[model samples]
Target: MKTLGLALALAVAMPSFAAPPVPLNTTDVDALVAKPAKGTRIIALWALDCAYCEQNLKALADWQRKHADVDLVFVATDPMSQSVTLEARLKAAHVDTVPSRAYAESTPDRINFLIDPAWGGETPRTMVIKSDGTRRALSGALTTARISKLLD
Candidate 1:
């Protein structure tokens, strides 16, 4: 009877867990990138499984809090993970603040316009987007020094 009661309690409590993040497709992603005002600049793209992504996500969040004018959008290579597994990992890591979106398989170029084929679907790939639609793409984990250099 006690075991059954415990099981029931666990089941009841599971619903309190955070719901998975909403998956945003290619068109939806473009809209997000386009939403910024005339002068909006962005740090875009990252995978959920990457350590560098974890650091960058946290740093970007902190940076955004200080520089509210800048925007950050994390793009996941694996779209399906965004809704459940990614959400859980992000939550577990206490990474909040950076808004995340999934890359649509149908439009790979539009999703990660900057990654080279050598990256092998790695995370922590990053891009800097200017208001004029110009972009600078970087591959590999983001370090503080690398981010500073890129921004400069």
Candidate 2:
């Protein structure tokens, strides 16, 4: 009786652990992008200090909930060593279910160029890649309307 209650309380008190972010490197960029999305894939690039990044993440997460076919791949601009912080942020945004990656080894510029040469190295930037290889890179807060337009 008492033990059961105590066990339940402990269970409720425990925080759920999300998987650590995988390391994303320059050499692996092509392979990651090569895997086609069944529908449209969103490669969201964000940084911990970017204020608008959170808004973009939430908007994407909301869209994902309503669209199962949309694949989300969150890439944290910060190094993989900061996976804990990145994971926590993604978890809070409710997008951790899709998993995420953090930059590794290579310099940030190299990774940025590899992701998209036109990407002006900005946080909250998104790369909309379709199966046919048409890619659109957007910078700043990505709103619901902008996310929807990607499908169009």
Candidate 3:
């Protein structure tokens, strides 16, 4: 019984392992955004460290709380670590909305490409794209009222 108990304790104490990172690229971004959202708005973007991004994330959390039907996609700007690292980061961050990583090697386009390369770059940079292919890049924190207005 003591041996069994020790074994169980050891198993419980084992550290959790996460998957590796996948790089972000344009093709992956296109593929991710291309999927239908049943007419919901899509926020496809590369993440970076910035105050505005945090505000947007917080706003998204609040928005999802009220409008469960609305969709919120998250993509890490890191092209180097796309899959495991990105997924782990999202999970760790407690982000329970749309999540993806930019493809590491993708064709160049206007939106998917990062605005600039700096700071490993900070996360939370986002773009609000409508169903009709219209898009608006959003920076800085947002409020529920602002989100509603944008959705409208």
RMSD (CA, Å), each prediction: 8.0, 3.5, 7.0
Residue 152, model 3: Cα distance from true site in angstroms: 1.8
* Structure candidate 1, residue pairs in collision: none
In angstroms, give how far residue 134 of model 3 lies from its true place: 3.4
Worst 10 residues of 1 by lDDT: 111-120
Over 73-123, each residue of candidate 2 has an lDDT whose tens digit, in order, gives 888999988988888888888677766889997598988888888887889
Ranked candidates (lDDT, high to low): 2, 1, 3
Model 3, span 46-123: residue lDDT tens? 454443654566568667667756566665555554465556555565553444445465332333444332223334
Top candidate when judged by lDDT against the true structure: 2
Candidate lDDT (C-alpha), each: 0.61, 0.83, 0.54
User: Per-residue lDDT for 21-42 in model 1, tens only?
Assistant: 5565655655655535554455
TM-scores, each model vs. reference:
0.65, 0.84, 0.56
In model 1, the runs with Cα more than 4 Å from the true position are: 1-20, 104-110, 113-120
Candidate 2 local Cα displacement, residue 126, angstroms = 0.9
